[model samples]
Target chain A: MTDPRLAYVQRKTRRRLAFSAVHLVLYFSFSLNWSSWGEPLSHRLGVTQVTGSLLMFILLVLIFIGMEFLFLQMESKETQE
Target chain B: MKAMFLFLLRSAPLLVLSGVAAAAGSIDGEVEQQPLNTTAIVMFLLFVVMTLLITWRAAKTTTSSAAFYNAGGKITGLQNGAAIAGDFMSAASFLGITGLIFVGGFDGMILSLGAFAAWPLLMFMFAKRVRNLGSFTFVDVVSQRLARGQIRIVASIGTIAVVIMYLIAQMVGAGKLIQLLFGLPYEVAVITVSALVLAYVAFGGMLATTWVQIIKATLLLTGVTLIAILILARTGFSFNELLSLAVEKHPKGEAILSPGVVFKDPVQIATIQVSMLFGTLGLPHILMRLFTVPDMRQAQLSAFYASLFMGYFYLVLLVLGFGTVAFIYGNPEYFDADGKLTGGINMAAIHIASAMGGDILTGFMSAVSFATILAVVAGLTVSGAAAISHDLYAQVIKQGEPDPKTELRITRIAVFVIGLVAVVLGIAFENENVAFIAVMPMVTAASVTFPILLLSMFWSGLTTRGATYGAIAGFLSSLLLIVLGPQVWVSVIGNEQPLFPYDYPGLFTMPFAFAVIWLVSVTDRSARGEIDRANYHSLLVRSEFGEKAAGEGAVG
Candidate 1:
């Protein structure tokens, strides 16, 4: 069996890597929305450029806040335990 | 082949001379003089006098290192937010983005949004943890678990590199702004601004720096808001009317409302946004501001308020940029005899200001932009000084046992030296339009320091060697890539081809730095590595619940 210390370290590293990946994906997704890649989303739906851009901006902020809130909840749970 | 060889031989001397010119840093060309605007001079002096008075007051209150570096952690959330806005809204954002919009049209809106998008990530990811962990510098957080001496040296080097690069860019921009507004010689303008920044940082420290930023932010916000309101008023508060007018007046017509007007490549777009996002994350001066707030909650509030102010200002920039096209497009008065922008394209927003409110309001806006440059340079200088004295001398060299008076004295001396160096470099680069030079240091920070900072905060496997190597990789790669990039190769060096085509290098280098740190740290089996691994749980707890992890009976 693997040492408990090594197993713990592996678990923590995976957690950190996962969280960082999510962070990267959010930023990248925001970039896609701002780029020509997301042009079809607005064009096909008949959304005006301004409304589409504003919606993207609002969605980005909400997602960021949600992620933070989720982490804070985990921290609080850890403290209670 | 013979004819081509003959042509090459004939043009060899001219090519050689151009290369020589590039080496001499003479590519930017000299600023042409216009009649001095006395209104601008008077308004600028008025601002100088007020900030000097605030510095004198701050000098009295700055009695200890804590007060000088982080203002004793007493600044209110709202005030800190304004100061943060002042710090980030920089000459590049105020003048450069407006200039881009003036010239590039719809492409300018993307640039403005790039500036606004970074703060959400900072507020959500790093601000509270940064505030909770460090007292003065971001390096403080890294030194908490890692070996202090080596980590401090690496972190300090990164901080100083970012500051110097940023300071040089701001100084040159400041000189050009003064030259346009007051018709002062570039050297004289650079020297004057540099000396004033030195005096501000040397006398008042962070307290003075914070207040200067606040005042500058308020002035800028008011100035830009008025310009936007005036632009809107001219259109009867109608966005559709403004858009139609701008499109009708612009040379490109409806194409000015489209994205491919400037940026055509998707990779380039993604690279620019990625650099900006990561760049803000690792900027030493911006992170230093977090430590000046009272607690994590205040720190979060600081980022939130800054985002609001910045978002509103960027919207204003968009309108003003398009508005300039509406009013001043093809207008001979705003252009020189060569059909070039009279004060260069960076003065697009200023021309809009003049058109909106005439000489009086133009002078106010000019003074506000000048104040913006000064406040930014002062912040950079103070932080550079701290890197040298606090990080290098007191912490690294002296092992945290330097004489307080001597260290403060060294910090003051460093400030003066940094200011002088900036002035000299500013004069040499007076002709270059490196307003995008601000982007360079941000990319560097994101590539080099942000990885180190993020990994140190979150990763248990982060050893001293891992952190050091990771940062070195990031630093060297960013510098090498930027030197070979189009900005330096084609624009500055007047080369035909760039070794690295992309202007921003963060997308590739930031991830590479993170990978290097991970690979090295996971293999590290030293005693220190094991201890650091064990320390991660506590760090996370502290990062999350503030003082509760330390058994301090739960923090507010």
Candidate 2:
């Protein structure tokens, strides 16, 4: 964290770590919660047959693809500095 | 040693055939013969010809160790990403997972989700740094900071162990798949896949392997998309209807859409997630893909693309897996006399293809699967060969200075030997439940390679002795647990109770390794350990910035 370049990299790394944390939390919550909570994912959404299980899966895929895209964009900008 | 290796390799097939027949409950059994479908044969032949052409072109350019190891570092982000996807979509995941879904409904989705759970983290953490530090292998990055020779030897052992286990899993799956689809004998199926892999890796090396992977990924994605579309078309393109239809037909009833239908244990769920998330980072073949790209941006982009493709693929699998329940579950045609799937649950993917598109589609899927096995094993072979030649032979045996010619020669020899071993082992494990072995590499990777690589790169205080001990500790603990886990003990050994209750080893093993490395490093005050810690500064600088910061080569 001494050199300016190194400091900048650290700043970017913090953001990456944040994203990773959210990812792990979201994933573990969706996957492991069913066992302890008695099928929380089975609850249906408002007026639709689409259940929480399907919703979680879609949310995960979106987050997976979206976060990686966002990270690539941010990293590209940072490296240009 | 060579004789013993060959002897073990040669005896592998016979051992699998007998499956310890002297014992009553061993794995040895009969393989149901498949009909000789000429269409499937034609499709598979076409894939083989296409692969041979790719290898022919690649062989001409593979002159040096660099070219052989990483395709001379000229691959693009898009190409590398597809290649990474190709590597990820092994026959085991593509077929085995769908099989799980076909039987267990929403429960089988544990693996489909578990598979891609690691990617964003891998992208956010390791991708760019790995590209910046290593040339041929990930060990290059580790050796940059630690004792080069000893660490490489240690890492090379780790890599080979992971690679060999992974290779056998794919080989056995491929052999059975080939027999089931193409009506070839088990031995012929194994040899055919191995021989083609030997050609691709020995002569064409990474370039051919990468292209083949890219090609296979494209085919697999295309095939999956077609089947998904057809399935959706049947249900008027509504996922809810598909789910409803699946529920109506599935024996699990409404549980098909609910969790805990397949995996009810909290420990099992946690273990599966942990292993998939961490073990992915340590897979040698997957990690090796980062170096194939020319620079860091490409490396990051490739991971992005890989996750995109895989994510898309997995979502599509939910549809197809449910579709198998909707269409294939009650279809007695696909069932044997015992009321099981004729080729087992894995055939759900292919059976669904037939339900929608008939024999031609089934043939196309079979061919794509054949290509998937070949590309994955080819990728594994090159990485395994690199461990043998680049890390073990060059870094350790030659003290880090290797003649280009000798190294390339050794790599090619290693490729042939590895291919032979895979073919033999494939034949040997024909009747065994190779699913455990298929996932073994991921567990092994989580324990040894993943921890060492992460500590060496990120943890400033990691000394050589600490890292080595961590590896040995991680590997031994994971191995012992797996041997005692339900898969081996209760299932394979017919024991009443498993010493290790869970199959996934990462939850216990990875943290244990990190702790061991931490304790050992903190306790060490040796002079050499001080140097190892001190080297962290240069390693960090070079990894974040570049070696010289002049060109793309230096701009990582």
The native-contact fractions of the candidates, in order shown, are: 0.06, 0.58
DockQ of all candidate complexes: 0.16, 0.64
Task: Please give the CA lDDT of all the candidate structures.
Answer: 0.73, 0.78
Candidate 1 local lDDT, B1-556, one digit each (tens): 2232233233322222211111111112234465687898899899899999999999998876667888889998889989989988875577666666665566665556666766766765678777887778989778777877888999999999888878776776667667766777778778888888877888899989999999999999999999999999999998667877887776666666665555667787777776777777888998999988888878877877787788778777778877887888767788655456676655767889999999999889888877888888888887898899888998888887888888888888898899888987787767665633545687788887889888777777888888988998898888788778876787678899999978778888898888888888889988877877776766765664565334211111
Q: What lDDT, from 0 to 1, does candidate 2 have?
A: 0.78
The DockQ score of candidate 2 comes to: 0.64
Off by over 4 Å in 1: A1-27, A30-36, A41-81, B1-32, B431-439, B548-556
- Show model 2 residue runs off by greater than 4 Å: B1-31, B548-556
Q: Please provide, for model 2 over B1-556, each residue's C-alpha lDDT reduced to its tens digit, 9 standing for 90 to 100.
A: 2232233233322222121110000112223557886888898889899989999999999999899999999999999999999988866566666666776666666677777777888898888888988988998888887877678888989999988887777776666677777787878877888899999989899999999999999999999999999999999998888888887877667776777555678777778777777888898999999999999889988999899889988888888888998998768788776565676555668889999999999999988888888888889999999999988888788876889899999999999999888877877887786656755777788889999998887788998899999999999888888889866887689999999888667799989988998999999898878888887766777777747323212111
User: Candidate 1: which pairs clash?
Assistant: B28-B431
